[model samples]
Target: MKGYRISLIATAWLATIGVATAYEIDCPTRINIKSDHPELEATPEGWQVSINKNRSLLLTSLGVYSDEPVKLFELKPEIGIIDGKKHDLTWQINSAYDENGNYVKCSYNGEEVQLAKKIDPSMKSCWAIYANDENQHTTAKLICSTSKLQEVE
Candidate 1:
């Protein structure tokens, strides 16, 4: 009878642990930038830049070429004012892959931004851009391609 009770208690504890783990949220990794405007730095790995409070860009080299800086990702504000009018900004990933596989994942304020997986064959590159607001949220692409990327309007 004591062994049966111990088994029951262990099973209940394991079930609780499983439930807690299943509900856990997976978060993306965030890079910390120290400057507010045009913070540019070059390291052996590659280059990083923060254009302003609303924009951050990173370029990493795979060492294919000596001087080429590959564009990895960019973060920008979702909304902006243009001509004294409010305008939505666009986010784009010009190139997201190479010969191996998908190579780009963009994020804003610590959240991953969904990008279209459309590869352009003619050019040896992939890129994308879009815009959103503080209250708006976007989805991510399941597959990475360059041809399917669309400009935000």
Candidate 2:
């Protein structure tokens, strides 16, 4: 009877863990940028920004390529996973033209990440970094094709 009780308890515990995990999706590995403004570069020295779905984080680094001083910003955008979660994100690193202004969109999310600066006149498309744990250093990439979000009205 004790063995049966132990087995039942183990089964219940396992079920509870499974259900909890099922509520959260794994972070993505890659994210693709799709935009009319196509002049963008992803380099170590270039600007990179990433958002973590799990940690609810947003990170940005500037002047990564040139001798110019680097700047970093970490903020938390209003993000939540009701159903589909966007672990990967496309970013607006540079702007080429002002026709559409600088904008970036991620998958499964309708909001766009607009640039705060007017550095580039033209729009550029680029991928942002993976929101890795500061200690663990893990990366999440986008699973499929790049997302095309509708412009906010």
Candidate 3:
């Protein structure tokens, strides 16, 4: 009975590891980010990333309250970068929605910051990620992805 329980626990742990690996974000090594462009293009004169192992980056318009979209990526001692500088992304999602939503709340980041839309059960996406260089607000580093808009009951 002891061996059987141990085997079950090991299997469950392995499954959890697999799930975490599936959620890893794949970022480009380099891309040209220009203001008023359509999307991120491969260019030598663009932003380059020096990814730091075992770290996460939650990048927002740091030190100011603005409507820039939030980005959540893995980080370490170093991570994402842009404009010839290593990005020092330090913001974290500390809340969600309800009493148990504190882990994803955008409240602590900035007062005037634009918050991402919370995912609902009915929401779905194309799974294809994109980015455009349009200064809809401040910077043109917005991620341009398509998703189905569901009608809330």
TM-scores, each model vs. reference: 0.20, 0.18, 0.19
Instruction: Tell me the spans in candidate 3 whose CA falls farther than 4 Å from its real position.
Output: 21-153
Please name the candidate that would achieve the greatest TM-score relative to the true structure: 1
TM-score order of candidates, top first: 1, 3, 2
lDDT (Cα, tens digit) per residue for candidate 2, span 42-121: 63676555533332233222111111122233222222221134433333322232233332222222223312222232
> How much lDDT does each candidate structure score?
0.32, 0.32, 0.29
Each prediction's number of clashing residue pairs: 28, 15, 14
Tens-place lDDT per residue, model 3, 36-116, is 333446645766644343322222331211122343431121233222223333222212322221112132123333333
Model 1, span 1-153: residue lDDT tens: 999999999999888652211111111222345454543365345655534554332221111111112343333424432223343442222334333333333444433232223222232222233323353433222121222224334
The alpha-carbon lDDT assigned to residue 7 of candidate 3 equals 100
User: Which scores better on lDDT, 1 or 3?
Assistant: 1
After superposition of all CA atoms, the RMSD between model 2 and the true structure is 18.7
List candidate 1 segments past 4 Å from native. Answer: 13-104, 108-134, 139-153
Off by over 4 Å in 2: 1-100, 103-115, 136-153
